[model samples]
Target: MKAIVLAACLVCMSNGAEYVVVVSKKSSFGALSVSQIRDVFLQKRRSLGEQKTIPVNVLGHDEVRAAFESRVLGMDRNRLNAYWVKQHFQGVTPPLTQPSFESVKAFVENVEGAIGYLPGSMVDAKVKAVYEF
Candidate 1:
């Protein structure tokens, strides 16, 4: 049983998708550090300099969302959920969520101050990648 579990873990790790943090191509902001991205997503920091920052998440337990949480936020689902719950009491909600990467890309592209992560292969001319993981 332990061996089977380890093998499953290895398979999941091997299949982990590459992701890139992106902003609108028209955004004046350049690349951001992981800390900056984290702060924006957590609602700890609202803007990059004078530009308002809007962070978007892939909704539900999708693999891309899991990867973003692990790589950018450095927190697993349970811990992140707990953090959101705590923040909710303070009137702080999690970032907006989209049902798909394509929608996320569109939202970031069309909405000023928007930011989101997409599978590396999905990035295109409409959005500029700020960070990758």
Candidate 2:
């Protein structure tokens, strides 16, 4: 299952499917470091300064989600599962999930502190992209 998902992500990347991390256009935050972005997604750090940061995840076994996990979070399935389990034990939780890139974009646009990742081509003026990979 992991191999299949990786293959799909590779195919998308080979076809010029660029992915980026995006935030609300109104957000005061600027470009974030990879570690900072990682912390946000992993729920290690909640707020970006004064604003309460809300991390959004791509739903299900999505290729984009897989890429984000591998390339951004640097976690594989087993590690991710264990991480989540530990978080659950600690009474913490993972980020919210969005069904699609469009939904993520819309959610980020409307919510001041929301942040998410999606295909770069789908980004519009409604949100500002902070990182790309």
Worst 10 residues of 2 by lDDT: 9-18
- Looking at model 1, residue 53 earns an lDDT score of 91
Q: Which digits, one per residue and each the tens of the lDDT, describe model 2 over residues 4-88?
A: 9999988876765488899999998898888889999999999988988999997887888888899999998689989999999
lDDT of 1 by residue, 1-133 (tens): 9999999988876565478999999999898999999999999999999999999998889998998899889999999999999999999999999999899999999999999999877878999989988
lDDT of each: 0.92, 0.89
Off-target runs (Cα >4 Å) in candidate 2 are 1-17
TM-score of each: 0.86, 0.85
TM-score of 1: 0.86
Error of 1 at 51 (Å): 0.6
